[model samples]
Target chain A: MNLATKDIGQSLGRFVLTTLGVGMLLMVVMAMGGIYRGILEDATLLVNEIGTDLWIVQRDTRGPFAELSRVPPNLVHRALAVPGVKSSREFVFHTVQRERRGKPFRMAVLGLSWPSDKGDWIPLLAGRPLRQNHFEMIADASLKIGLGEKIQLGKETYTVVGVTHDMLASGGDGIGFFTTADAQAIQFDVPSEAVRLERSSRAARGTRFELAAKQPSLLEFANLPAAELPQIARPQVSAVMVSVLPGAEVQQVAKIISGWDDVSVFTRKGQRELLLEGTVEKVRRQIGLFRILLVVIAAVIMGLILYTMTLDKIHSIALLKLIGAPNSVILGMILQQALMLGALGYGIAFLAGRKLFPLFPKRVILADDDLLMLAGIVLAISVLASLMGIWKAMKVSPNEALA
Target chain B: MNTLPEANSTNSTNVSDEIACAIETKGVTKIYGSGNTEVVAMRDASMKVQRGEVVALLGPSGSGKSTFLTAVGLINPPTSGQVLIGGEMVLEGPVAHTNLRTFRRNHIGFVFQKSNLIPFLTAVENVQIAMELAGESRGAARRRALELMEYLGVADRASNLPSALSGGQQQRVAVARSLANRPSVILADEPTAALDGERGRQVMDLFAKVAHEQGAGVIVVTHDHRSLDVFDTIFEMEDGLMHRAKKP
Candidate 1:
């Protein structure tokens, strides 16, 4: 056996304890990387789940997540008119905090056209989809709202008709689906006192217009009844999602939609990029910075441990030198020990990560590529950490063995 | 007894025709530091050891016995001197003409006062590693290690770790390791200092037996003169100076 194995065998208890400590630190690092992966997944969940090939939003706006986007409710018709556009749906997205059993529950609400096959976009874990457009909602299972439970939003109460899994927004808020009409009313419905004030202001303005009118045609508008006055507020949608026919170029259809005034279009790939780079970029950076810090900490810990272990063997190293053992042999021993420690730590961390990630509130996705990358990084860190011991071993004088 | 190869004429010194020696030094001196800090550790120390000869280096503490041994072992080169090992000029002053590590591995061995065995390794593996480092095949190294342990009468404890062996047994394993490469010279610094009188004498006798049987030049630094009769020659050091003592 090599020096590393033999040394470990001799001091198995200390080796195991050290490996456990390093393993805990490694688990935290891997978890941070997994958190970043989760954020990316959450950011693109809706965009991917909607099964739409293109998105049409208000001009000069990124999307529902990046900026406030509002388009006319009728924009679905214009999107459907584009060549190769087989189907179009109005999509509404907004966050709402509602009181549930005395606590405030924040949820992301998505509105879609009713009675369309698009309702199937949400994979149900229990119950059924919303058959009737009004007073019905599908809640993500993470919200803990049971099917058939009633939740009050604005002036209306809706029943939770279905529950879906992993349906969360970029911010890790649970998602609830509603019909377009119900979502719009919940979003824009004014309080009774404000509506009364608006009506009174309009009546006062109409009375003054009647006194100042000079032309005959203008007099007709001035004397109009208050009930007949034009209403300025109308239902609006955040964006229109469009699906293209098979074999159709989505970019071509997006270009056609982009030609419209006061509107922008995005293909599927563009929407995903916007969600990832625009919506969760800050969270990604934070997690990335944490990952880097943890890696540095791990490296420092490994280096210090190795340096200490080498120091403990200083006399033995001197004896080896005196016995005509070359510097390479001593170096190999230290390096092998470092690598073994790293491998042990990694193995423990991997097992712990698999069991612990699910317990985190946010989804933690540990991909095979990520695991492979981390393994390579750990090996590199082990080599780099061993350099300190190697340097110290090289400086050991064989004469010290004589004294 | 195994016969060692004869030294070539090219490797011999002009004054050593009669002595087929394994080691020779010419006026070796080792000076540490310089200026106000300068101190002479060894002064004009010279010695010759023939193949199959075991010599005792007896001196009081701080008498530069270790300095002389280290210098001859190629661990610390002398400040001003020439050292020839196995008939080849290996060191001139503090400069090494050959790769000292490789040269030491092939032609020199060392046993320290504490046994200084690798704590993690068993007796046989510890001995085998020396041959392995010299580029011997693993199987050959293991076979030779087993043979050495058998010859040293420690074959029963070959698989026991150094910690499991007694003080004398550990030293025996160390001797086996020192002989693993069939070195021309073995330099031991108080190989039995830690043992009791009986165990220490046994270790000293093992050294003499090793030197005679393996045909190697052995120089042992020690303070225990009770075992002086085990040596073929004896030298005493005082204030960095060495001279031959009357044979006992």
Candidate 2:
């Protein structure tokens, strides 16, 4: 007795195909949400980890992820000397591209201020955290490095001590955790030939000085291996991670460090906010705008579709009216069709997403609240879209059925 | 002879009128537009139909046969007039004495030129929906729908979609639907226009059979002269006036 459903049943092929079209459109909308969530998750992954209370970076720079930042390694000692400062670790992070297994591989190397911090923070899937500082590493499972695997980095070979899952670098690249000294060595590593060339150039410059002429032995000092030289400045680190004592106000400690002109200090929360709002703000907005556009487009398409479906039933509607069908019955027909279309479309999007989302390089989190919100939105859009069709049906006069 | 114009509105039948009048209209006139675009579709059209009788409104296209049918069906109220169904007043001028939709559902039925069956529904559902909308229970409506289809001799095609049934079958199903609520008056406009002469006569005969057997006053608007013998009473229209015609 439900005329609309019975009508749809008569042309089920067309109905199914139309529902599938709506589903595909909704699937794109779902992808937009998933991609947006993925970007935010990837952006904040490292900020949530690390467990540091403050980040001390080069003056006027945002933390390392937002921009290039380098602070002297001694900044860690300065941070430790502050009252209520529990611990400080030198942070060194850089990306390394090396040929492995005859293919180019990119790895983000993060220096754990080891012996004090042995990467105990990483959620290991296998193996153990770093015990020795020099050449041991905790590799992200993304790096495809197995436990006990050894790979040459910089001037030394490192053994993979632990393998962790999903512990990616800020850029979403696989990360390898090493000691600060080992990381600095890898960052500043040079070939022996280049070292020879650089040493000779320095020696030649030293010989031109009047001090070198008065004491020619000074040139021999420059000729010694670069490591044994005394004139070179100490190696700098990307930043310093500082943690406060339990029950100590991190804001107060940060205010104390703010007095130092050489470095800018930020609480961990500030770092995350900067990365989200500054580093990935544009991408997030673009995805959000695209999501809005898609929802609007879906609504418009559904409106047109429902309107056309109403037009198809124009004669039948008039006939029903002539037979004394009330407005509620006619309205129910159109409204129910719209609701069915939207419900089926959303169902398709969820099923298709379960298979498709994983293929994306970035993680997609379909949160329960987000899914529920989208369902509500779909319901609203369905009702709004059906209004046009209902309006059209209402305009059909029963007299149209005569003659 | 109660012809039209002056004679049409002069007589009003009392409850004791013979044959038990099922539908009566007095001085029904329909006017559309004004001034330069002024047109009168039906003027002083009065009619009386009794139970167990089938009346045909015969006319050429644009002669207001359909206009009068629509007015009688309560779908398009006349610009001026009064209508009575089952010997009780139901409409005056453009105003209805009762809820027009509910009143029509219980007392009037309509069949159009091309069956006008809802395409999405099966033959039986098309019939059942009318009764269901009239407040019949689903099971009762369906059972009555099947019974009416059976009475109309299309019971075998009850489950088929409108498109699946033959043209003649679809029209029979339309008739079956009109009778689903057992309305006292049935109004049809060119109900056989889409059928061949033989099929047209058959459906016209079916209308007469429905009225005679069910004791409903039936009126059909048609220009087809081949089926004139099927109607118990006949009326012809020209311009915007109606006059009773002698049955063949």
Candidate 3:
């Protein structure tokens, strides 16, 4: 029998226990890697799902996901006027919290103009998209909101028209889609009392200015009906998402929009990169640090275990030496046992991670490529860890067998 | 059929052309430390044994009997000595004329007091590994191992691990392993020290049988004098010095 099989046979319980321990450590490593991948996946899901060719945001901003970007709602017209632009829609993005059944739920609220196919940004899993723009909303399936349920936001109650799957914002929050007019009313409409207070405060200030100038006409200007007064609060949108015509260059359209002084533009690729690297960079580094720490711990643990096992078998090693077995033979035995341990441990970790990762509160995406990469790393670690045992076995004197 | 090389004719001057010496040592010395703190473990030890001869080594504790056995086994090379196996000089005064590991694998076998079987392997595998190390095919090695186990009277226990075997059975497997490579000489250090008198005598007789039947020279270091009659010759060691004993 080969040394690895023989040694494992001799102490099956210890071998299994050690493998289980290493498996747990490897599970942490796999989970950490999955978390990093999950962050990247979540960061780009919205951008990928939207399938927009260009994003026009407030100038000097990194787009809606990375920074606060607000552009006038009228920017959609300008974006549509750009050459090669096939469709443009004003998109509003914000975070909101609502109490449902006495439980608080948070979600990203995305406002898109209707009658434009831009409402198809989120794929519906059940029910139909918003046919009426006034008080209908589509909720992410993760929010657990059922169809036909009414939810209150600000001063309005809206019916859940449809449910969508995997529609999440960069921060891993579920999304709710609303018509642009409803969203603007919910976001920008002030309470009637507050409006009255503002109007009175402005009229009093105007009266004081008129008395100082000895002209009562300024009060008339201030007393003008609220509708007759210039509309000071216009609808503001987070960004204008634009789609290019078939065969049209996306970069060309982005360049045309970039000429606007009030807004900057990003191609789809640039927006995806900004979402991944700029928005989730810290989380990636944190998960990376955790992954590195777990790997080092795994290597140290395997090294110590292999070294201890070698020390325990020093006599057998010396006997092998005395019997004229070459150093390569003994070294092969140690290396084989180490690799076997690593393989078994990785198998256990992979199975356990697959079963357990979904239960984690945060998104954990275990990709096939990540699994293969981790396997290679574990194999390399096993080989390097066995060196300590090999060194000790090599130093065993054959004469010790005679003693 | 065995593939081992025949003994050189030039080194068989004292024997018939057909009977060659299996092992010859000339003034082998093993010294530990140096100067005032130096200790001699073996001094000017010399001997010869023909093929198919079984020799017993008798000594008191700390008399360097193990030292001589290890030195002759090519494990602990002597500080100053020359060693020849099958009439070929393999070692001279701490230097080796060939790769010692390969030389030992082809020419020598060793059995220890404790049987020292690899606990994880069954009796057959323990024996088979020795042959495999000498470049035998796995099938051939396994066939040879079973043959040796049968010859050593442990064939029924061949599939059992060392832990499941009795003390005498373990020693039999160890002896079978020693014979696996078809070596010219076998060196056993206190091979019967852990057995009772009856079991010990049986193990010693097995060594004698192996030597005579396989045409191998055997040297066994032991404190048991009751089995001395099993050996063709007897040597005694005292305080690192060796001399021929008066044969009974």
Q: Give the Å shift of residue B219 in candidate 2.
A: 0.1
lDDT of 3 by residue, A38-136 (tens): 889888987888888999999999979999899987888988888899999888888877677888888888887786843665678988888887889
lDDT tens readout by residue for model 1, A245-352? 999988889888898888989887888998878878888998999899999999999999999999888887987887778887899899999999999999999999
What are the chain A TM-scores of the candidates, in order? 0.89, 0.93, 0.90
State residue A87's C-alpha deviation in candidate 2, in Å: 1.2
How well does chain B match by TM-score in each candidate?
Answer: 0.92, 0.91, 0.92
How big is the positional error of residue A61 in model 1, measured in Å on the Cα after superposition? Answer: 3.0
Model 3: CA > 4 A from native: A185-230, B1-18
Model 2 error, position A29 (Å)? 1.3
lDDT of 1: 0.85
Q: What is the lDDT of residue B194 in candidate 2?
A: 92
Provide per-model DockQ scores.
Answer: 0.51, 0.65, 0.58
The 0-to-1 C-alpha lDDT of every candidate, in the order given, reads 0.85, 0.86, 0.86
Clashing residue pairs found in predicted model 1 = none
